[model samples]
Target: MSTGPNRIMDEFAKLMTDAAGAAQGVRKEMETAFHSQAERWLNSMDLVKREEFEAVREMAIKARDENDALLRRIEALEAKLAEKGA
Candidate 1:
């Protein structure tokens, strides 16, 4: 009688362990599927990566700064020319 109860308990513990392992596998599969779908959706929208967007933004800022510097130089040259003429 004692051995019979121990055998039942052992089987129950094994069943619980198997169930927990199966749950983990299912969870991983779900996460992988969700990530794949999200990537596909983002690709369809033609979105740029964070690094690429930042690079383009930096380029634009640099170009604007260069333009402002050139404008200032041109104005200074014009003022000097006017002074010479006067």
Candidate 2:
């Protein structure tokens, strides 16, 4: 009689363990599917990735800085020319 109850308890514990493992697997599958779908949808929307946006932003900043430097050079050259004329 004692052996029978112990056997039943062992079987129940194994079943619970299997159930927990299956639940974890299902959870992982669900998370993967959700992430895949989200990425696909975002791509379809044609959004710029962060890296691309940052690159473009850096280019624009560089161009602006160059423009400022060029403008200052032109102004200095004009001042020299005016001094020579006077």
Candidate 3:
């Protein structure tokens, strides 16, 4: 009689363990599916990637800086020309 109860308890523990493992597997699959769906949705929105945006931003900054430098050079040349004319 004692052995019978012990055997039943052992079987129940195994079943619980298997159930826990199956639950974890399901959780992982759900996470993977969610991630894939999110990525697809984002891609469909025609969004620029971070790296590409950064590159374009840097180019704009460079062009602005170059324009400022050219403007300064032109002002200095105008000043020189006025001195020459006078």
Structural similarity to truth (TM-score) of each candidate: 0.88, 0.87, 0.75
User: What is the model-wide C-alpha lDDT for candidate 2?
Assistant: 0.98
Off by over 4 Å in 2: none
Encode model 3's per-residue lDDT on 24-64: one tens digit a residue.
99999999999999999999999989999999999999999
Model 1: lDDT of residue 81 = 100
lDDT of candidate 2 over 1-86, digit per residue (tens): 44788989988999999999999999999999999999999999999999999999999999999999999999999999999999
Deviation (Å) of 8 in candidate 3: 3.2
Runs in model 3 deviating more than 4 A are none
The TM-score, computed over Cα atoms with residue i paired to residue i, of candidate 3 is 0.75
Q: Measured by TM-score, how close is model 2 to the native structure?
A: 0.87
Task: Find the 10 residues in a row with the least total lDDT in model 3.
Answer: 1-10
TM-score of 1: 0.88
Rate residue 37 of model 2 by lDDT. Answer: 100
Tens digits of per-residue lDDT for model 1, 1-86:
44788989988999999999999999999999999999999999999999999999999999999999999999999999999999
Candidate 3 residue 7 Cα shift, in angstroms, is 3.2
Clashing pairs in 3: none
Instruction: Score candidate 1 by lDDT.
Output: 0.98
lDDT of each: 0.98, 0.98, 0.97
